[model samples]
Target: MWGRTARRRCPRGLRRGREALLVLLALLALAGLGSVLRARHGAGARAADPGPPRTPRLGRREPVLPRPPVPANALGARGEAVRLQLQGEELRLQEESVRLHQINIYLSDRISLHRRLPERWNPLCKEKKYDYDNLPRTSVIIAFYNEAWSTLLRTVYSVLETSPDILLEEVILVDDYSDREHLKERLANELSGLPKVRLIRANKREGLVRARLLGASAARGDVLTFLDCHCECHEGWLEPLLQRIHEEESAVVCPVIDVIDWNTFEYLGNSGEPQIGGFDWRLVFTWHTVPERERIRMRSPVDVIRSPTMAGGLFAVSKKYFEYLGSYDTGMEVWGGENLEFSFRIWQCGGVLETHPCSHVGHVFPKQAPYSRNKALANSVRAAEVWMDEFKELYYHRNPHARLEPFGDVTERKQLRAKLQCKDFKWFLETVYPELHVPEDRPGFFGMLQNQGLKDYCFDYNPPDENQIVGHQVILYVCHGMGHNQFFEYTSQKEIRYNTHQPEGCIAVEAGMDILIMHLCEETAPENQKFILQEDGSLFHEQSKKCVQAARKESSDSFVPLLRDCTNSDHQKWFFKERML
Candidate 1:
């Protein structure tokens, strides 16, 4: 009986063990099914409404952060023109606007500092890819001298907003002895809340060139970018510049500078066609359409254009290369010819100067600069004396007074050129800048044109301002042989060009009207501007079949020039100052 009871107890224990095993297996199966259902539900949820993406494990994958999207609804977004009707007090403020910033500060203050710009680049640029991870970081230097509050901050915000945080080290604001009250503690306080920004105040009034050097000295990045205080940087503006500098350490790159309307504060995008920098005999920076040679060299529309010079207000260069090139000429005072000086140095000293179409920056082009321009002439003279070599004579011919201007000592600069063994200005002209028209290219009379009939009176032309060179009346005035307004260049092209600057004026005659006016010189040498200076010293108009004759205006005692029938009269006889010698 004990044996049978033991056997039954054993069976009962075994049965209980089997039941516990079955329960455990069933629980495992149920849990597995629940997990499958949860996974399927999760997948369905993701398909229906995916939440913010989960970043891959940090070390496992390096992710590219997308650029911050510009606010579409913000004011002045998409670079649309902002027009505001002004009356009463608002209209009165416009004068003050011009006096301060040379821009419509009223409108600038109203627009959002973080406003969006339209994608002005070619569609090809959108497809272009760059290795952002490997690109050099830049420290943007902005030098302001009593810059307006809104425009200055807007410039700062535009850079901070548009530039990749990883690529931008900092923005160094160099105050060039600003006396404005707002630019002191108030400006400091405003920038204090911003990250990656530094303010350096000069003890005395340092000019733009020195101020930029100050900022560059404080920079701690692979590249140094210089921007005007009143500028708006666009998307992708900094990348191509830094990329070019990364690829070619000797390359100094600039963006396609867009125009920001001064009167309206409207952001005007530049034409897709790039304009490279060139200078006239004046040694002043001027823009010209990219030559066919440069365009042919480009494999794509977005390729970098080899520019002879820069607009000087905006550019990026490797810090090491900049220092190696001796940086800016600290001897330069105020603002003027540094662009041409640096541009010449770069090419002559075995460096490349480029303008990248993929990069764009909007600049506020003022009606007139709100500062004294007395130093600009001196600055230009300095550049000519340093880098121009024998070519300096061309500049002196156009601007005779510049020879008398007291440009500071350039012995150190000359020594630097000798130290670097830089190529001569002739090489610069023949190789880097062949498009520049050297005045001596054609053999013709050039100087202050004096008329024999009018005695001491010369062909004096004074435009309303420098920019209004075209479509101005040429008048007769007392000949002052200082070689300014009376200067004229009778080119081999048979066009009497006003020798003031590039985009020089040509004396033109209307089809029916007898007026002799100064018009913008055309490349085609239009028949109307063609004139033949005869052996007898008469300016015969080729197109009108007439001669430029001096006549007294019935309205006043002043003599005015007009096209008249060709005659052997003394009134038709003219002589260039060089011919008289």
Candidate 2:
């Protein structure tokens, strides 16, 4: 009975234990199922409950940092200080290896950004149009004077070959009295068939200055371009000049002048790069290269630069401004000095001159000068003297060896100045165009007389009062005490001697010296005072006391006449100093 009771209890205990284990297992399974259901539900909620797409936390947002305030003056001291500070910090940061590694990473990221960005926004890419139709229209004027037939024909053909038809309007050839008969007959016969080509011949010689003026007067186009009779037009030559003129009405444009060897008739090309022609105080032409900074800054070849002066051989200008500036100083003598005169006047009177790189022409440099009916050298010298009078002192300073006595007449120039009411050279320098480089005032002695121990002393004197001399004058002095040989000896002995001894005058001063004063006249007799010096070292009665003193002094070798107190007398009377050729 006891064994049976024990067995029953054990069985009951075992059943209870099994029931508890089953309950624990069921709870574990329910917990697992609930976790799976919650995970699925969370995923469903994430998919269905989206209002706005959430940015990934990895790369979407960056922490904000305040930017430095901009300085009031971008290029001022404050801005410069800020820039220096930043640069210093950057240098400091770059010095550390770890920081440099981080910078490398950042730079790699920046490079990736650049690669992925749109090409249209990229700054480094260049877009250019290769077509010629987009260029501006140009009218070319060729002035011929006994030009070689082959060369003239080649020039026309070269124009046709190089210049686009749309850009070219008219090629007017102004014949300035060509001696060659075939040039007229053949040029008409050959070029007449071409479009927009016309020839105008002057029965008499009009020279280069007037010839160009005549052609320009007849120009129907907005821009008037001048070219020599013998020239080879380069590729894409016309557009640059026309483009510049279109942009600026007052722009005077020139082409790159390459040298054509006269002996070989071959194009020497350029030495290396384009050079703008310049001028000296003497009104002589020179050439120098364009600066590199200028090349980088200019958007096109049309940009204006500080040209020393225009090339004058090939240039284009607007018709309106040309007329307004009175069209090339009509009073200028023949060809030579006209270009310089025109250049100085244009620059001084408000005009910008530039040499365009895009336009190029080859000029034939002659081994010998071409024959001219109008004494070309003398005519040029005359023009230079008349137009560049103010600059003469500076010129003689630089070229001390040059002989400059025989230039041209200024009578016509005087007439023009009166007619135009033109401003004085000083006014032109200070007001009309201050940017132009006018040479500084230089005062010195020049010529053979200065070398012979005689001082050609002349000082530029401003009037004490408002009254100043306008033209020029020379005071003639006849020293009654000395002859020519004695005068020469005295001048040789003394450091300062009178330059002129031919009984005519003192150095030529500007026209304002009016009051005549005689000083230290030994002669008291009125009839004896007025005398003339004979060739055989003698004196004869003339009229004035000053004349007598001059003649008597010229006759003797021992006496030296001194100029003293300013007075109005026959001895101080001045005559116009005429320059002998």
Candidate 3:
């Protein structure tokens, strides 16, 4: 050992080299052992503590929630959750929104499937079937004529908001030759992004009535819902209308209208509960409601109350029924009296007209009258005259102060009415809707006709054939004809007599007559000559016409022959009901 040690120390360079090599080998061995230990430790940890079970990846497949069965009573509380679920998806957060929407649709058809989903997910899903599928699909038809952009956008958004996505098949926008600079292009461009929106532009101006007819022709849905260009929709509007249609197949339904301030574009609350009132000969719309007592007596909201007529704007009906009713009277010149014509025909032709409380829409009432089209106004007046001929006597009876223009021919409506086998207006009042408070004389009540009896005869006398006979009976009053303006009072109990030549002479008729007529005499007629009938049926005259002749005729003919002569007179032959006074 001493000799070996001496040899190793003999070379210092050799000893240093050997020591370095040994150190290198030891470090390599230690590194290898450390790596092996780390591998073993990682495997042991993974095996000893199992991680939570991994959920199956859904991948590209859409998640579906089962559809719920349609409830028998859709309006009940049981269905409320489902409806909220469907509507709520519209506001979901971006990441989860697509999945939730798909789930909502699937659940709408299968509620049971939704019930099976995890309890945590129940609040996010809607599983009720709103049974609109049994009802006809509705096509919302809107006419745009230089409509304001904001108004149009609001209308579109409102419809989308209130209307159920499944029930709405299409929205038809008819452009009646609007001249607004950017309206056509902007409308088209914006609507391009929406599905089931159709834009139709007419090169020439087709009046409102005709334009609507054209839109209806193009519509594909089973039901037609007509909306004005300027309107905002309220919640639950579509459901009520759809329900009504389902209950009464032949019924025409209108939503309650709330007025909007045109200047501010703000909603002015509803005028009142919607009531249906007829027009006087002047074509003024009257507001009346179901008596409070009568409304309170009803047990359910489904009561079929009588409405004298419907407001032309925001009305709905089955497309088939609309077409069968002659579709807005092609003969009607334009927009004016078309609504009245539609109302009368629907009521008189075995169809029911109603206003639903659950539905509401807003319209802009003009602060000032539009003055651009004198011809259009005249045309509207002409249309009302042509279509509301039978009700003319009743109209004038209620509106004595109205100055009516002569009516032209209406052969088209007559032909259509005959083809549909429409029942007479009298039959409609007496049978199908006995609850309606229609007076015996519509014109007389409205102060339009000169005599209640004049509606029966075709006119045959005099120059200006249209004006030969006074339409309404003259009423004599104790005061100067100026006591009340000459037109008949709508709700007064006393008989009126013409005491002065003032244009304010009131028209008088029998208390129970179905129709009333008024004679609008020249403004300069003598006051003393005005005549009135007393409670005893005796004539009291200031002597405008021969009092002796009037008295003799009052007793012998009961004023029937004079009325017949006027009715037959060529002047009164062509009358229609104008909606605008």
lDDT of each: 0.82, 0.48, 0.51
RMSD of 3: 29.7
Candidate 1, superposed: residue stretches over 4 Å from native:
1-74, 441-444, 462-473, 481-484, 492-495, 508-536, 540-547, 554-556, 563-569, 578-581
**Candidate number achieving the greatest lDDT relative to the actual structure:** 1
TM-score for each candidate, following the candidate numbering: 0.82, 0.49, 0.54
What tens digits encode model 1's per-residue C-alpha lDDT throughout 86-111? Answer: 89999788778777777888888877
**TM accuracy, model 1:** 0.82
Greater TM-score among 2 and 3 belongs to 3
Full candidate order by TM-score, most accurate first: 1, 3, 2
Over 4 Å off, model 2: 1-136, 291-304, 373-389, 395-581
- Candidate achieving the largest TM-score: 1
Worst 10 residues of 1 by lDDT: 1-10
Q: Write down the TM-score for model 3.
A: 0.54
